[model samples]
Target: MENFNPDFLEEENDDLYEHFTFTVGKGQSPLRIDKYVMGKIENATRNKIQTAAKNGGILVNDVPVKSNYKVRPLDIIRVLFTHPPHENLLVGEDIPLDVVYEDDEVLVVNKPAGMVVHPGHGNYSGTLINAIIYRFDNLPNNSSDRPGLVHRIDKDTSGLLVIAKTEHAMSHLSMQFAEKTSEREYVALVWGNVETDEGTVEGNIGRHPKNRLQNTVFLDDEADKGKPAVTHYKVLERFGYVTLVSCKLETGRTHQIRVHMKHIGHTLFNDERYGGDAILKGTTFTKYKQFVENCFKVLPRQALHAKTLGFKHPKTGEFMRFNSEIPEDMQQCIEKWRNYSKYQELEE
Candidate 1:
C-alpha cells in the first residue's frame, strides 16, 4: 500500500509515499525522534529516519525538526517522505489504448488487464503511460512526476482510468481522490457465499509483518498499525461456492479490496496474490473439481474489474462517470459459475 491506492492502485499510486502521524503516549520516556520512529515503524532504518529529518520530512507539532529532537509526552509527530523514484525513464511507446473519453483537461481510457499503468522495475515499457505519452504531449506530472496519471488500478484488474492532461487537471483530479469525492465501483467474484446482502468492512490496512508482498487487516487495538481503509460490498449474484459482489472504496489503502475481502473470509476468486487461486470452496466431486479448474483456466487472474469510475471534470467542474464491459476472462468465468450454480440447484 506498490505505489497507488484504490486497493491501493498497487502502492506506487498511493497519494503520498509516506505520511505518518503519531501521538506520544503520556508515559512515554524521552527519546530521539529518529530512534523513536525506527521503533514505531517496522523496517525503518536509523539512517533513513536521519535522512528524512535532514530533508525536513520530520515534524513536531507542525514544526520541522532534526533527528536529534527529543520526543516528549503528548508530542505530535509527523513523518512525510515520497517513495523512491519511479516512471523516471518512461518513454512514449506506440502501444494501443482503449480511450473512452478525452478533452482538453482530462482523458479516460479503458485499460485492459495485464497492462501496467506506469513503468517501474521489471516493467519498464508497454505501460499506459508509455502509450499515452506517445499519443499526447506535455501531459502534466503529479507530485511523483509521473505524467497524466491521477489514479491507477491493478495490472490484472480491467476497468476505466482517468488521465490528467494539464497540471490544473492533475491537481483537481488528485484532490477529488484524496477527499473521497470521486466514485469508483469494482465487481469481483470471490470465494464463499457472503452472508450479508450488503456490508461495510472497516479496518486499518498495513503491510504484513512477515509477508512483505501482501497487506493485512489490523483492527481495534492494532488499528494504528496500518492505514485506515474502508470497503463497501453488495452481493450481486450468488453461486453455490462463490459470490459475485460489487465493492465501493471509501479509502484506497494498498490492496484494500483484496485484503479486506480476504479478511471477511471471501477471498476474490483466482486472486493468487491474496490466496484466492486455489480451490477455497466447492465440493469433493471429481466432476465439480474439474469444472472449477476449467473456470480458473478461463479466467487466470483475480476476478475483479473496475467496472465504473466517476469523477468531477477538472476544468469544467462537471461530474462524469464512465463504464466498461467486463473483460473476456472474467465474464467467461462468471458465466461458468452461473451455469454451475443453476445445475447444482436443480440437482438439490
Candidate 2:
C-alpha cells in the first residue's frame, strides 16, 4: 500500500506530485537501502536514490536514512519531496469561463480548447486559474500555484474538469485522482486505422532526452528511465486512414495517452509535438494531400478532447458525471473526414 499526505501533493500538469511510501514485506531480507529501494521504485536509478538519501529525502521508520542503511523486514520506508519542480506567481484575470455545475463544495467547468489550465512560465495570463480566481474567491489552493484544480488536461484539449471549493473537497478529490478511481475518458482521432477495437498500452514514459518538450516511452534497455504509464483505448469509429478512438487512463503520466498511442504507431492526428502534423497514413495523391491540409486548417491542434469525466462527490458521496461536446473546429474536421472516407469507398 502507498501512503501520500494531502498537504504534500502539488497539482502540476495532470498528475499531482507527492511523497511515496512503501511498507517492506514481512518476508523481505536485509539489504542495502539504495539497492532495496531501487528495486521497489520504478524508473529510479541508484545514483538518484543515493543522492536523495544524502539530501535526507529518504526515510526509514520516520527517520532519515543513509544510502548504505540496512533495511529490515516490515520496515516502513518513505521518499518525500515536498517542493514542486516549478511554480510561477499567479495573477488573476477576468477571462470568462463556461461554468457547467457549481456547488458549495465543488465546481465543474467545460474548459475550452486553447486555454491554459493554470499559471506557469510563459503562460502567466488568460489561464483558467486566472479566470477561476476572478470568478470565485476563497477557493482552496494546493502547494503549487494552481488553486482549486484537482487535475488537469493539456491546454489544447477541450473537456470537463472538477474544481474543489473547500479544503476537505480538495483533499478528497485529490485522493480520488491519485487512487485512479475517478473516471476520465478522452476522444481522439489518430492517423492510422487502428486494427484492434480495444487495447491497453503499457510502458514507462519519460521526457525525450534530445527534446525536453516531448515525451516518449522508454522500454527494454531504458526500462528504468521514467515512471510507469498505462492507457486503455477502444475504437469508436473508423474514417478510412484516420480512426476515432476513446481512451481511458489507468495512469496519468504526462502525455500518457498521446505518447502511448504514438508508441503503437497511431499518433493522434495533427499533434505537432509528436510528429503527427504531416500525413503519416493514406495515399500520397495531390488531392488527398490537399484534403488533409484543409482538414488541418479546420482543426489546428491535436485531435483529442476530454469528453467525459466521472467521480463521486467529495461531500455528498454521490456519483457525478459530465460530458462536453466536441469543439466546432474538431467537429468540422471530423465531418470532412467522414465525407472523404465515403468518397474513397465509392472510388474503390
Candidate 3:
C-alpha cells in the first residue's frame, strides 16, 4: 500500500458558491437516497452525497432525510450541497488485495471470486474500491469513490483488473478500453462440448422484461432499444461432454459472455441466469448430467474467470499485460470432470 494526497473536498463556503435544485422522478422510486442524489447531481460522488444527507443537506418534501431513505413515487427531493472542502473521501481499511502489479500510476490486481468491484446495494464496504482506498490514499477523480477503476469484473468472476492512480492515468486507460484497444480474455467452463473450435457471437443486449435482473439478446429491431454486445470465443479443451473455452470481448455489456454463450447453446456451467442448468440437464451423457447437478449445488456462481488483460501503460504509453490463474474451486471442478470422464471410459 502506498500513501497519496487525499483528493476529496473537506469544507464548503457559502460565500463561494450557489445552490442547485433537482427533482426526483418516478423511475427513481425505491432506490437508495445516496444513489438517487448521485444520479441527479453532476460531478457529485456517492460518498459526498451520503455525507451531505447525513449532515442534513438532503430534504424530502422539506424534511431532512437519511442515505438509506427509500424514495416513493412523486417524492420531491432536494439536495443542498453546502459541505466544506475535504481531501479524504474514503477511509482506508485493511482489506486483503491480490496485487499482480503496482506502480506510481496504476495497479493491477488479481480480483478473487465473489468480490464486488465497488460499493452498491447491500454492499457499501469490503469492496475492491475500499481496499484500494486503504492501499492508496486516493484515486484519480474521474470516478468519485471508485478512484482508478476503468472497467469491472462480475462479483462472481475471478480475474485480472487494472486501476489508475492519477487523473491522467485514469483518462488514458479509459480511452483504451473505450476504443477496444485493451485486450481482455476470459477462461470459462461451459456446459457442453462446442461443435466448433472457434466462433463469434454478436447481438444487442437489453434488460429482460420478465426478469429485471437478467439480460437478453435481441435482433436488429429489438436491438435498437438495446446495447450492442460482441464476444469471440475459441475452444481451449474438449472433455467429450463439456468444453473449456477462452472468449475475447469486442464490446462489453452486462453479462455479455453469459448471454452470448447461452444464445449459441453453450452456456457457462452453473450460470443461473442463462440456460446452463437446463443445458446440463439435456446432456445425453448420464455421468455428465449427474456431475453437473452435484457440482452446481456446491458452486456458488457461474464458471467465468477473467484470465488475461493487455493494454498500454497509462502513464508510460508502453504495452503491458497481466494474468491470473483460475481460482481453486473452478480448477477443482475441471479436475472432477476429467476424473469422471476417465472413469466412464474404463466402464466402456
Candidate 4:
C-alpha cells in the first residue's frame, strides 16, 4: 500500500503507531519475518522487531504475525511500533502554548494554526513537540520525537489535543482511541450548501497514487489499496455559496474529513491540498470572485478546525471534554460569508 497520511498513520489516542511497512518480493525465499524485515528496514534491531511482533504490530496481509512467522513470497508485511523513528534529537523550544487543562497524567493543549504536530520530512524544528518538550520534562512516548502525543491534527488545522504525561496514561489513552471510544469533532466551511442535517461518509482512504501529497477515497476495485475510514457530519449552518459543518470522526484516517467531504462533492473551503481553494460552488459575478479572493486572503489555509474533543480520563473513570473557539482567520471568513449570504437573500 502507498504511504498513509501522517496525521492518520496512527489514530487519536493510540500508543502503537505505524511508521513503516515492507512487502516481500515475488522471488523472496521463506525466511523468519523478523529477519526478513531487519534486512529491509534500516535502523531496526532484532529486539525491537520481536517486541513489535509480540505487541501485535507485525502484520502479514493484514493479519498479525509473530516474529518467527515465515515470510513467503508476495507477503505484505507492515510494522507498527509505539515510538517514532529516531531522527533528529528532540530539543525543547520556549514557544507559547494555549493549554486548556492539565493534570498529573495528561495535558490538553489548543494548538494554533500553522503548527505541525511532529517533526517529519522538511519540518524538523519549531513544532508542537518542540514547544511541549521545552515546557515539560520526560513525556512518555515511543514513536518519532513526538512524546506524549495521543492524537494529531494537520499543521494548518487548529484544534484540541491531549497528551499523555505518564506511561499508565499513555497506555490507557491509547486503548481508548484504538477501541473507538473517544469523541472528536471538527468545524469546517465547505463550498456548496449541504442538503442534509446529518450524514455519514464511509470509504477506504489512502494516498493518491499520482499525487503522494494528497489523499483520496478508494471507490475502485483495488480493495487492498486503502484503510476503512468513517466520518459523520452535521450541517451547523449554511451560507449561500458555502456551508459550515460539524464532522465527527469514527476512524481517524489521514485527511479523512478532507477527503470524505470531497468525495461527497462538498470539499472544505480553502483546503489547498484537496482543491477546495478553488471556487467549487459560487456565482460567476466578478464581485463574488473578488469576495472569495478576500476570504482566501483572510484564511490562507484550509477552513477546518478541531472544535471539540472528549474521552475518559486516564486516571479517573470520569469522562472529560474540551472545546476550542474557531481561529480568527476562519471565524472572520465565516462572518464574511454569513453577511454575504444574507445580503444575497435581500437582493433577491
lDDT of 3: 0.76
What's the residue-level lDDT of 19 in candidate 4?
64
* lDDT value, candidate 2, whole model: 0.84
Error of 1 at 177 (Å): 0.7
What digit string (tens of lDDT, one per residue) describes model 1 on residues 259-302? 99999999999999999988998788899889988998999889
lDDT of 1: 0.85
lDDT of 2 by residue, 280-348 (tens): 999879999999999999999999999998989998899998888988999999999999999988999
**lDDT agreement with native, every candidate:** 0.85, 0.84, 0.76, 0.86
Taking the tens digit of each residue's C-alpha lDDT, what string does model 4 give over 130-183? 888888898888454458888899989998999999989988988888789999
**Cα TM-score of candidate 2:** 0.75
Q: Cα deviation in Å at residue 37, candidate 2?
A: 24
TM-score of each: 0.77, 0.75, 0.73, 0.78
Which portions of model 3 miss their true places by more than 4 Å? 1-91, 143-145, 275-279, 282-290
The per-prediction tally of clashing pairs is 18, 0, 12, 5
Error of 3 at 267 (Å): 1.6
Q: What lDDT does candidate 1 reach at residue 333?
A: 96
